[model samples]
Target: MRHGRSPWMIRLIVLVLRPLLMVVTRRDWQGAANLPEGGFVLAPNHLSHVDPILISHFMVDHGITPRFLAKDTIMRARGVGWVLRKAAQIPVYRSTDGATDSMRAAVQAVRDGEVVTIYPEGTITRDPDVWPMSGKTGAVRVALAAGMPLVPVMQWGPQEILWPYSKRLRLLPRRTIHVRVGDPVDLDDLHGKELTEPLLREATDRLMDALTAMMAEVRGELPSGERIDIHTLAKPRTTYKPKEI
Candidate 1:
């Protein structure tokens, strides 16, 4: 991605585009005051393509534009890549051994007073149930490593924009999106510790717990303790065929 101030053209585009987006989507962003003043990870559940945009667009009044830690593949398109680059979004390659570099970049962004948003689930949920799947510890690690607070963000209504398990992108009118930003998670006790898998997982569980609480609040459901166990979430499933053959 290229590095430079967004051209006047892009600024004008945003000026026109954002209002149009608000008008089209009729997004209602709650808990706007909960947004952190500076750089931090806005970790939210990943359900639809519009999740990031919904959260970020509403928070534009908060003074900092939210940047995403998108997988490097999204930049493959010549046109799309150019836009993302100009917008200063960070590219992250999870499969490569150098994924740590992305974390470092996020830390730097925070130090520079820029907000970085990430979906710790890595990708959207593929579970038969819509519950949040086990999230990677990258968000926790980044928070601890950067010595920055982790803000838990819970958003819904984007799912209404596009149906689950469907390839269709629904952009029709009258769909309302809700974004709820929670307070910054204090990880001061966990700061400066050795970055081990267990430590990271523990911190992540704390964050997810907060996220689930926020999600429940947004969805108007009772908060329960049915969290997924991250340790065993990735075990391969085995299938057995009948012996009729």
Candidate 2:
């Protein structure tokens, strides 16, 4: 299960996507030195639907082929599903018993020396200012279970190209995407500890705090220090439309 050469399908996708990403976005990627040589969990803030492509571009350019924990619906699609399977992406069956299975697969992937990218926020930001909200415990759980490094990667500017849940693409401006990779989160003290709900929540908060701070450095604006909880919102998490400022 160790990481090997990229499959043909993944290579083809890189060929097609790398050029398009370069054309549409300028890169301000930093902290490649922070990436570990072996397996690790990549925890990034979820901004827009286009985040996977943008983050994958950064990982691939730096010689790491990231395996995402994608939704099962995407994994069940006709053409794209086939590619994801071939590329060894993990599928998440949300709200079902199979959800735990997805976490197991992700932990195994990390243990087997593959980079697994999980969006800790679980979905696009529900915050009106597009700041990262509170995170789910899945990413921290996977990293702790596998005993691997948990790297916090913050990305800004994808929302400028494509607003959250929007179908329209803003390709005219050629935005510059800012990506900053932080040092592996220090969980050495909690590595062998039991995966209790309180412990997991604490770790998730640390990861989110690191992400928000890195994001502030990228955007040069301070966050409000309060994270929005999707569960508290009246509107449905996935169906709520983005309000214009």
Candidate 3:
């Protein structure tokens, strides 16, 4: 467990951004008590690019340091890369480190007692309604591999700040970011079973369903039975796609 500059960097951001966000974004956080004291998975629906920062504020406030698995190419950027590296964020090597390599890193992060946040969909949801779409199996592998709980956390209103797949940033009116942290998804039965394809799909589906339900609760509406499956619906490729080494 290499302790990078995450300690000070997280505190620094929270010290500054927390207050600013308080004034700019109203918060509705529930089920925070469900967050375990040790290592765990903080899986959330992908709504905006700024979700990591927003959710970081939420988890950090609850004393959980978030470790996100990002793309390796994004780590080569001029400034953002530096911050990610400094904060010890995991970079998924889509074509280099192998498929399960990032999983290894994430498992290690969870074992190290840091909350690892994964977008089960692997990318932002393609659902036109901004609801939680489909999910991948990465989160399931990490949680089961590390023997940690997979906590479903959902957030709304970040789209109000920065709409998904859009460049326009609406920050004047101070939108309310509604984040609801729900109980950990029950993976005991699936975890004990063989890590098969059908089992993985079932596990990931349960995870996304939990998140989608939470989002519906936050919105006070019912979600559609059909959710967008990113792997098939719209392949929003990342900078570098991780492949098996």
Candidate 4:
């Protein structure tokens, strides 16, 4: 797979953030060999807001530039939006007519040999114990549409630096972030099948199961129960305030 040059903005951002990340966190990254050549979908579990930074650090070190599917609100933010655009990230207009447009753009990016990182959980996990929760169908749809490998990249320890929904950062004690990239999910059997709701749900379950299992390996324990489905909660966990378990 041929590599295209990264935008100047991406280089500059990496030049600045890479050093800071190296200082603030130690990495226990593995499975670099599992990253396939050329373009593919990278699906990682969402733990904290800082996940993208740490995950990007890993991908960059392995010579892959990751394009994230960011929320449209962030894409429209004054300073941040400009940076994201300049860095060549894709914007996702959630719950809008433009959502389909965003997915098409992502699939094109993969076909063009760009690694697109999609957080399967869509948002930070609402699981009280910080385990990966159930996922949405976006990642599966993209991988299926593009006919590309869907790789599961599981991570832990970003929450130690910044807990979910918390505004504080704990940087004194440098944390060790653990990331493992699993082999591409086996979807060959379902590739030519119709993209039905049941088919999508099955693919998503396989993706989430792979992620949760890899996470269990990193955390040294299995999840206490079934993966938490955020939609089933009594109250939507949407605020920045840390929720009580």
Candidate 5:
């Protein structure tokens, strides 16, 4: 991380903004204690830029300063890159196949006892029909490689804070931002096993499952809504059984 204000300054900023954001959105966070105080992986469903900031700020209360994975091009920008670098954000080269280095960086960060936040779906959701799109397996890889715990976080109200695909900013009245965090996922179960495609897919699916559940709660939607079961969904579809012939 580049030289900047001390950790106290960062904590101070978070201390002030936490209550302000809570008041503005009437937000209430649940399961915040699920956040690990030391190094850990934070995977959240990405809908807007606000998701990262909100997650980071909420985790701050638990004394976790999370770093993000930004696009490499953004890091190429002269001034903005300087600030991002100073803030310790890692840049992944999305345009090329050189993302391995970025992955390595994330693994190292976790190994060094820091919280690394990743938006597994990569870009924000554009389907307009779901809580999240198919998640990338990079998060799983990092967690498994570093042997760190993975925490799934879900965020809501950002889309309303700034409408999707629009330049207009609308902090509409009475918007409530709710965030829910789930317990850390243990990678020990998969320890010493080869991370084949099927295994990685299964693991990423589990990550998204937890995220989806938490997001539904945050959005105040029923948990039974189009449930996503990774193990079941990964299986081939079978013919429906007859009711009573």
Candidate 6:
């Protein structure tokens, strides 16, 4: 597989994430080889807004440039959004455009053999304990459609640096981000089957289980048996946030 990362951009990322990481947090990443050179789905739980930087830093350090599906509003943000656009990250809908456009693009990227990173939970986990909650089927759809591997990745300790839905940053003592990558999810059972709602949920739950198990290993505790899907339960009456990647 051809490495699509630019040498100059890689050097720039290292120069940026290296010193900043040294001061902000320590990292423990396992299963680098789990991410193949060829196209694949990277499914990781969302912790803080800064989660991408840490994971992207690790991927670049391992010599792969990942493309993430970002919210359109985020793509229109001030400085960082500009950087995201310039780096060619894909954009998705928040309350505006439909999600079809982004999924089409991501599927194409996977077909072209680019490493596509997706946070299964469209929004950050609402799990009080920060365990991985339920996932939408977008990631699984893309992987199955493209005949690519769906890699399950879990990260702990980023929430310690910055909590969810908060603006506070705790860089005082410096934290260590525990990142684990598991083998490709077993989709062999679902392959060639019709893409029914039940099938999609099964595939998605398989993904969530893989992530939750790895997360349990990292934190040395089991995740909540009852998953918290904030999108469905948060309102339940009026509006439902679009199922997204």
Show where candidate 3 strays beyond 4 Å. 1-6, 235-245
Model 4 lowest lDDT segment of ten? 236-245
Question: What CA root-mean-square deviation does each model show from the true structure?
Answer: 6.3, 2.2, 6.0, 2.2, 8.4, 5.1
Q: Which rank order by lDDT, best down to worst?
A: 4, 2, 3, 6, 5, 1
| Pairs of residues clashing in candidate 6 | none
22-111 in candidate 4: lDDT tens per residue?
A: 898999999989999888999999989888989989888888886899999999999999999998899999899999999999999998
Colliding pairs, model 3: 94-241, 94-242, 94-243, 98-245, 99-243, 99-244, 120-136
Per-residue lDDT tens digits for candidate 3, residues 1-245, read 22223566666767888888888888888888887777888899887878888998887777676678998888878898987888778888885656578789899989988789988887766566778877888888889889899999998878777777766767778788888888899998976667898888899999988998888777889866577667676334433222211
Task: Judging by TM-score, tell me the better candidate of 1 and 5.
Answer: 1
Estimate TM-scores for all models.
Answer: 0.83, 0.93, 0.90, 0.94, 0.80, 0.88
Off by over 4 Å in 1: 1-13, 127-129, 222-245
Best-to-worst TM-score order = 4, 2, 3, 6, 1, 5
lDDT digits (tens) for residues 3-113 of candidate 6: 475545445667877788877788898987777668888999887777888887777767777578988898999987887787788898755557877887888889898
On TM-score, who's better, 4 or 6? Answer: 4
**Candidate with best TM-score:** 4
Please identify model 2 stretches exceeding 4 Å from their true place.
Answer: 1-3, 238-245
Candidate 2 lDDT over residue span 41-154, tens digit each: 999999998988999899888888868998999999999899899988899999999999999999998999889999998889977678999999999999999999999999
Task: Please tell me which model should have the higher lDDT, number 3 or number 4.
Answer: 4
Cα error of candidate 1 at position 181, Å:
1.1
Candidate 3 lDDT trough over 10 residues, lowest sum: 236-245
Clashes of 6: 0
Candidate 1 has an lDDT of: 0.70
Task: Give the count of colliding residue pairs in each prediction.
Answer: 0, 0, 7, 0, 0, 0
Q: Candidates 2 and 3: which is better by lDDT?
A: 2
